[model samples]
Target chain A: MHELSLITAMMDLILKDAQSRGIRKITRVELKVGEFSGAYPHALREAFAVASRATPMEEAELVIEEVPAELRCRECGAVFRPSETGWACPSCRSQNVLLQGGLELEIQSYHGRDGDVGQGRSRQGYSSGEQEES
Target chain B: MSVKVVVGKDILAVNRKRAEDLRARFKQMGIKVVNMLSSPGAGKTSILEATIPRLQKVRAAVIEGDVATTRDAERLSHLGIPLVQITTLGACHLDASMVWKALEEMDLSRVDLLFIENVGNLVCPASFDLGENLRVVVLSVAEGTDKPAKYPAAFLSSQVVLINKMDLVPYTDFDLERVLGEVRAMKPDMKTFTMSCRTGEGIDRWAEWLEKWVRESQ
Candidate 1:
């Protein structure tokens, strides 16, 4: 499955990030998987288990957040989730709509073992766009 | 005393960056690359087989991707055009790195058009950008009409869609109108070509359009 390759590539990133931060053990990995991103959550979890075997992230828990697919109406600028009746906008019935969301695939954060909150560490190679410490 | 640190990195950011770099390289080199994606047995190779002979006016090459076979490369190499095969062994899609590596094995200096035939899958192939000038999704009549709706990502990101196996449309229950309707729902301006390689029904039109694209890229 493609999930296996995806998982392997993700682990490589995780390992590289962990190494840079001098984090020996990863407690958890937080990810966001959009509904339209084409990666099934269950399949990703299964692939993670198989890909992380005997690795530094083997004991890590995988946490995922699902984002709903959203569309924007071209005619009226209406933002709405996918409709059951059709893809027509709820605010304005327009077939000329564009996808605005549900294609996100991001690794938001990770919990590293035995690290202090504010001060105790080496130069943690934290490479996230959001520098907010969870 | 575990610390929860915010990384906020796109998981695909690295791959996307690589693809972007490759895109820049292609642009600087003035190579028109096409990434063709489809489901297994959707006639990607067959389309190339039929289209290449007619593309004599354009200098073309192909990089074939598959899970575990070089048969496709073997087939295209016989055409006497520069072609290479990247067998993923078990991976379902071709990523930017694989293509970047494949480039080192071939000579693309005088290549006007480069077609990368991705692994035959509707889902994962859409996620990875392989630095192509155009993205073409091929769907055959035998695959049914609901594919565009079911696999919106592939159809949504494509520039031109090739409706293959039209010769079998009369024999199968596939509805061309329904498929096109769904394709329009995803992308209103997507260019489409309906043809069957078995009968060479609409290859000439496709070849002309592709030749125009190649010329425009140059």
Candidate 2:
């Protein structure tokens, strides 16, 4: 239900960065959403569809990568995926556990059209884009 | 003509930064903040009403969050403590910015314990950080025992869990052991307190623990 607010916050960040970099239109957005991040992927997709309207991302494709929940047992030094019914360590049956993963809610990257470089130039031979990891 | 921009930024980075700033400010002022979360009608207000008076050595303040109501703020007004009411108007949760705005309205010069009663929803609030020293989840017996299993995010994120409404347990099918077991399975070291605000049971223990934390923060 708070997906709309989350989408708005995410759009604020992405659009600001995109605008500063002279990105005229975003084509794809990749987000890493954890299973336990307290946000539903389907809901986020719906929110994105609504929030991205009339913006640079109006026709963008929203890509979500879901991360599974992981727990590490303190006593047994074991790492495992927690069962739906319990979070105890499978190796030692210890309840002392720490959530090692699956709380991520991050925007990994986006594909955007370069506004400065593509000003009515020849559109041929520019299908593949260069990769930049920050 | 297309380029990939690698952001790798957290979605809630703005809220997280605000919460961190508030945390630093609270630490400088020697204030221990307790953020309370629970479902609707889970005795959050009643627990506050019962526990506030028992904080004999601590000067407490409250920030009440609701979708749209001043009643909770009014309930604690007779306690004579500095209180601020934040009506979200329709928001399901209170983020850090809202809390920062609320803090501007209060004077925390002599306050030792600050309680922020978040809006009544277990899901969205768990994702928000309000710069509180402790996160307390109040689960009443009337809410049923499967709450921990159903709402693992809240139970896992909270450091303390208060099982309220002990008096109503006999009438309901609330299994105390099952709830505690599930809670422990998620967080083994979660500090839990079973109390009844109506009957005044276990209030002293809860209040003393809170006062101790507040005094230790100072």
Candidate 3:
């Protein structure tokens, strides 16, 4: 899927930002993807795992928050999320509406920790098997 | 302690910037690029095969993007036109960088109309812009009539929607009018064309539209 490409772009930006802040390794990445953005969360998760290998972002927890697709009625200017029937605005029931904010793909934030030479191999003692909680 | 940095940047920002640069270059060179998206077996390549010859007035070039095959490039190369092919290896869609590289391989001095045939994907390709002047999504009648409803993003982003394989419409249970109505609802001012590559029914109309844009761009 193109999620590989999407994740690649995200990782590039994240790594750049992380590097600028002197982050040697990343612990987690929080991303908000809109439903209408055409990036499925499930597929993106799988892509993230494969794409982050052998990098400073290896084994990082990827927290994805999905944004619901919203629409603005062209005829009535009423903004609402589409129901089961379709993308028709709930207020005016107009099918001819513009999508407002369902197509978002952005990184809200990320957590990174500096590499410690003193910790060395001891860092793998306990937390190696456990995920560091926020 | 781990630092949690609040970085609110669009993941596609890099691609968008590159796309804007390509757009400026195209504008400077007076080149018109059309990005075509479609699902597999939707007659995109066939439509291109049909339409290219008809637009004799404009010097048209094609950039074919496929997941893993040079067959599309080979097919278009037979026309003796300047065609560059980008194989994404396994990627689902083509991005601005890919098109920018493809453009480097071609001589744009005499080229006025450039067609970027995107990978056969209705979903991911809609999100990536190849810096085309116009975006057209092709749908074949055999694919079913509710396609526009199922894939709203493609219709929303496209300025033109082409319904291909019209010759097979009578055989399939495709409701042409209903499909058109749904397409209109998504994009009221979208330019639409109904054509069949096999029958050559409306190729001239499409070619004429391309000619008009090519001239206007110049």
Error of 3 at B60 (Å): 0.2
Q: TM-score for every candidate vs. truth?
A: 0.92, 0.91, 0.90
Model 2 residue B104 CA deviation (Å) reads 2.0
User: Which lDDT value does model 2 have at B204?
Assistant: 96
Find the 10 residues in a row with the least total lDDT in model 3 chain B. B1-10
Q: Which residue runs does candidate 3 get wrong by more than 4 Å?
A: A83-86, A115-134
lDDT of 1 by residue, A1-134 (tens): 57776677677887787666666788899888888888988999999998888988899999999988888989999888875444667776667889888887888888876544345554544335222344
lDDT (Cα, tens digit) per residue for candidate 1, span B1-218: 56666777777777888999999988887888999999999999999999998985788999999999999988788789889999998888999999999999989887888999999999999999998889999999999878876777888889999999999988999988877866776788999999999999999999989999899768
Q: Give the top-scoring candidate (lDDT).
A: 2
Under CAPRI classification, how is model 2 graded?
acceptable
DockQ comparisons of all candidates to the true complex:
0.58, 0.44, 0.33
- Local lDDT at A49 for model 1: 92
lDDT of 2 by residue, B1-218 (tens): 67787778888888898999999999999899999999999999999999999988899999999998899999999999999999999999999999999999999998988999999999899888999999999999989988876777888889999999999998999999888988988887899999999999999999999888777767
**Would you list the rank order by DockQ, best first?**
1, 2, 3
> Each prediction's Cα lDDT score?
0.85, 0.88, 0.85
List the candidate numbers ranked by TM-score, top first: 1, 2, 3
TM-score of chain A of each: 0.82, 0.84, 0.76
Residue A74 of model 1, lDDT score: 93
